[model samples]
Target: MIDALTVALGVTALLLAAWCGFAAYRDQPTKDWHFIGMAVVALLAVVQLVIGVVRLAGGDDPQQGVAIFVAYLIGSALAVPIAAFMSLTERTRWGSATVSAAAVVLAVLEVRLYDIWGGVGG
Candidate 1:
């Protein structure tokens, strides 16, 4: 697993979380800008997913079990999109809250992904 890429994803997720949280605190609904942030995070997640799959296919086994690792990869990749869709259902501060929650969740998942990869330099 690439530690740098993992760290990048985590940091981006956290930033997005902070943005959404600020919007929510201001009682603003989710905006196009927020969706753009989600798209960026989702793109990074997709890249990470592809890299993980290729690495695994090339016989680089994760220290953790394959099922768990792959599960994290897929879940991380889908999280932002799922949250965005849910946000679309509400047009209030709650929508921003949903996105903020999703971003935080993605960050947590990234950390777990790192652990599942057996940590940096593993």
Candidate 2:
């Protein structure tokens, strides 16, 4: 995995979390701008997923094992979209909260991805 990309994703997710969290705090549902932000984060996650797959295809195995690593990649890629969908259904402050929670999850997944790839602490 690319360390810089991992860090970038993590930072972006945290930013999204804070943004949506504030919306929830203000008793608002996720708006168009929030979805756009989610889209950006999701795009980054998909890019990361593709990179991870390409590396694996090139015989670069993650230290933690391929199955788990791929699972994390897929989960991370889906997290935001799934939350966004759920947010749509709820259409309340909780919807924003859901997105906020998913962003936090994505951030956590970024750290775990780094570890799975044998980053310093792994």
Candidate 3:
């Protein structure tokens, strides 16, 4: 995986989390701008996923193990989309909370992924 891209994704996730957290704190629902931010994060995740898979296919393996790395990749890629769907269902401040939570989770997952790549255990 590309180190800079992974760092970018992790930072983006935190930023998204902060944005949604602020919205929830203000008693607001997930707004169009939040959705756009989510989309951008998700797009980054997808790109990472593709790159990871291609690298794997080309015989590059993570230090931790392929299974765990791929799992994190897929999970990170799906996190925002699932959260966005759940947010759409609620249409309340709680919806923003859900997105915020997901964003935080994604950030943590990205960090974990980096650790795994470097053979560090959680």
Candidate 4:
């Protein structure tokens, strides 16, 4: 896996979490700008998923095993969009909280992805 891309995804997810968390704390729903941020994170995840698949096809194997790695890739790509959809249905501070939680989950997944691929270099 690409270390830089992994780090980028993780950092971006954390930023999104902080943004949405602040909004939730302010008792606000997810705004259009928040959705824009979600879109950015989702796009990055999709790109990462594609790159992971390509690497796998090229005979690069993840340390933890292929099935789990691909599962994580798919989950990472889906997490934000799923949370966003859930938030859209509620239209309250809880919605923002939901997104914030998803972002944190995505960040954790990113770290796990790095470990699964046997990331070594800093």
Top of the candidates by TM-score? 4
**What is the Å distance of residue 44 in model 4 from its true position?**
0.3
What is the C-alpha lDDT profile of model 4 across 50-99, one tens digit per residue?
99999999998899999999999999999999999999998999999999
Lowest summed lDDT over 10 consecutive residues: which window, candidate 4? Answer: 113-122
CA-lDDT, candidates in order: 0.92, 0.94, 0.92, 0.95
- True-vs-predicted CA distance for residue 94, candidate 2, Å: 0.4
Worst 10 residues of 2 by lDDT: 113-122
Give one digit per residue, the lDDT tens place, for model 2 in 1-122: 37778889999999999999999999999999999999999999999999989988998879999999999999999999999999999899999999999999999999999989888521
lDDT of 4 at 23: 96
TM-score of each: 0.96, 0.95, 0.95, 0.96
Which residue pairs show collisions in model 4? none
**Tens digit of per-residue lDDT, candidate 1, span 2-116:** 7788999999999999999999999999999999999999999999999998888988878888899999999999999999999899889999999999999999999999989
Instruction: Please rank every candidate by TM-score, starting with the best.
Output: 4, 1, 2, 3
Question: In angstroms, how far off is 64's CA in candidate 1?
Answer: 1.0
lDDT of 2 at 37: 99
Q: How well does candidate 3 score on lDDT at residue 27?
A: 98
Which model, 2 or 4, shows the larger TM-score?
4
lDDT, residue 116, model 1: 93
Model 4 global lDDT (CA atoms, 0 to 1): 0.95
Off by over 4 Å in 3: 119-122
